[model samples]
Target: MDYIIDVKELRKEFTSHSSRSGLKGAFRDLFTRNYTIKTAVDDISLQIKKGEMVGYIGENGAGKSTTIKMLTGILTPTSGHVRVNGMNPHKDREQFVRSIGVVFGQRSQLWWDIAVQESFRLLKKVYNVPDEFYNTHMADVIETLAIEPLLDKPVRKLSLGQRMRCELAAALIHNPPLLFLDEPTIGLDVLVKLKIREFLKEINAKYGTTILLTTHDLSDIEALCERVIMLDEGKIIYDGALRQLRENWGEGKQIQFSFAEEATHAELQSLTHDHLVVWDQGSNASNWTASVENNEDIISAVIGQVVGAKKIADLKIVEITTEEIIRNIYEEGAVRNG
Candidate 1:
């Protein structure tokens, strides 16, 4: 199979320098230096197929940015190998970049003082995009992102959400087969985020553009990616389907029941020994909450036990969130290491 991205034992390292503070020590430090070697990316390997949207997620300082930089030819790896589209990104940077588009949420790639359209035109000249292709692509992007109204406005004057929309459009003008999106929805309102998500889905389906998305938002993963790669301390801890991650690591459902008649603590305890039940006074003195596995049999058994003793007025069951499952994995790893 031909993979768009193939990484083998990729590693990146950095050096930190420290100097003495006092004048005498400073003078001595001029002659002697202390350096500490930090590994930002450990030996990691990954393969992504053409047109596949993969979520690359991790906590801060987990080497997500470092790996992206290497893939985009902005940073050189210390050791090992990386190949994108059958080419070494760092070795043939000029050619490699023409095949890929990148967006950094906190950084602006547009000219601050220029109109959004002018920025698009400038990118067209820089990338040498043909007139026919440019016109069609820009039109599609403008309509999809709803940026027609903001075309004449300067990049510096647009709101965060508007600027992000333009940023995405600018990156897509060349119609690169691969796209790297780093926190593309950061700092946007709910409505704007939804628009952006919709645009991404449309583009991926229409063009089959392969995407590698990195974000702190787990919802983005749930909405966009079927496969996820989770990193920790410069290493990948999990790489599989999103559903499998939930099945393997996710905590089960949390169920709450509102009873018409108050049941004593002893009565509740006698009903089930498998679940942890707590009286919720804020909702109602008779309401109770239980933490239980997501198994149908277990849930049915618990429900039967409760209904047998008390009349249930209302009930709600909430499944565990992706954030909670990832957090639990990190905490468990820490505990085991300690």
Candidate 2:
């Protein structure tokens, strides 16, 4: 496989100091300094092939942003190395940046007060994009991302979802081969979220753009990335196929069913393990839900005990979600132990 991103032993750290607010404390802190070495990124390595969409996930201070900054040449690593497109990003920033695009969801790359199209025009001049290439690329992106209606609107006047579409289009104006998305779908409705996911998939399939996405939304990881890299306390805890992560650390598989009439909690308890997990009583209390670990030894037995042809109105098996997987990893420390 041709690797687009090759990182080895990458580490980053920052010096945190106690800053005093008042004059006395400020003077005291200035003379008697107190600081601590905070490791924002630990010794971590990863290889991503061209066209691969990988999820980089962690808690707020877990070094996700630190890794991104290093990759994008915004911050220098304390140690280790990173090569994007076989070139040192920090050393060859100008050339490397031309081949990659980054979208920081919290910050707008587009000018705030200007029209969206004006911002794109400015970026074209900054990136030195040729007239033919710029026009063609922008046209394609506008059509694909459905940003035509947003072109004339000032960025400040657009809704979050609309602005995000414009942001994506702006990132692709240069037609970079690599894209870095940081919480691109943080605040959006279900329909808009689905549209963004579909658009990303289209881009990956059509252009083979390698994407590294950092997001709190687990569904983004689930829908887009086949491989997920999980970070905890600046160290990579899990790096593998999403399916493998689910099978290994996911709590269990859920089996939901609806019945003809209300079923007693006691009767439901009789159907599963001694420690049963079920959430049934809604407006329609007749429906029952239960989940159990999907293991070879008891899967069939569990299914048989839970489902009967007529008793169950509907039955389906759902693998544990990425959200649940991460939740379990944090709360129980199961994945870390393994």
Candidate 3:
């Protein structure tokens, strides 16, 4: 099988010069430089096949950006090998970039002073896109992202949400096979986020585009990616199905119950000391909650008993979120070292 991305024992390090803040230290530093070496990516190996939407997640300084930079041909690896589209990103940069599209949430790829449509036209020429394909692809993205109205507006004049929509369109102008997204929805409103998410799904389904998404927002990961690769301290700590990660790392789950209005306080008072506890809301004794330890039959048993005791209005079993699970792993040093 031909993989879109293949990395083996990849490592990157940076050396910085430092000195003590004093007249004598400054004089000593000038003659003999003191250098500190820090590793950004350390001995990692991974592969991404075509048409896979994988989530690459981690806290700040976890080397997520560094790895992406190396993959995009923006930075060279210090050691090991990286093959993106069957070529070395650094050695074959110009050719490598044509096979991939990258969107940095904090940065703009478009000419800031230029109209959105003008920027798109320039990109078409830069990528040497055929006029037929450009017209067809541009229409698809514009309709999906709803950015045709903003097409005449300069990039500097668009709002954050509108600009993000345009940014995505810009990246997809050439319809590259592999796309890399870094915090694609960092600070967008809910409606804008939904639009972007749906648009990505359509792109992947329509063209089989492989996506590697990096974001601080777990919702994006939960919504788009099936497989997740988590990094910490420059090393991969977890990489597998998102569902499996939740099952293994999640602390627990909560089962919330809502009773009928007619249920008296005395009728539900026993539940507080029993398996479930009452969350006193105003004068109503309706809302109740229970904590189920991990995945077990105890949840079923709890529900059975609750059903027998009261007129159930609503019942919801809430699983622990991905963010909470990740936090617990980091706090407890439960790194997978994948």
Identify the candidate with maximal TM-score.
1
What value does the lDDT take at residue 70 in candidate 3?
Answer: 96
Ten residues in a row with the worst lDDT in model 2? 273-282
Alpha-carbon error at 180 in model 3, in Å?
Answer: 0.6
Candidate 2: the clashing residue pairs are none
Please give, for residues 212-266, the per-residue lDDT of candidate 2 as tens digits. 9999999899899999998888998888888888777775776676777677777
Q: Which lDDT value does model 3 have at 239? A: 88
Residue range 175-236, candidate 3, lDDT tens digits: 99999999999999999999999999999999999999999999999999999999999999
TM-score winner, 1 or 2: 1
- Candidate 1 error regions (>4 Å): 20-27, 256-290, 296-315, 334-338
- Rank order by TM-score, top first? 1, 3, 2
User: Highest lDDT: which candidate?
Assistant: 1
Candidate 2 residue runs with Cα over 4 Å from true position = 19-27, 255-290, 295-317, 336-338
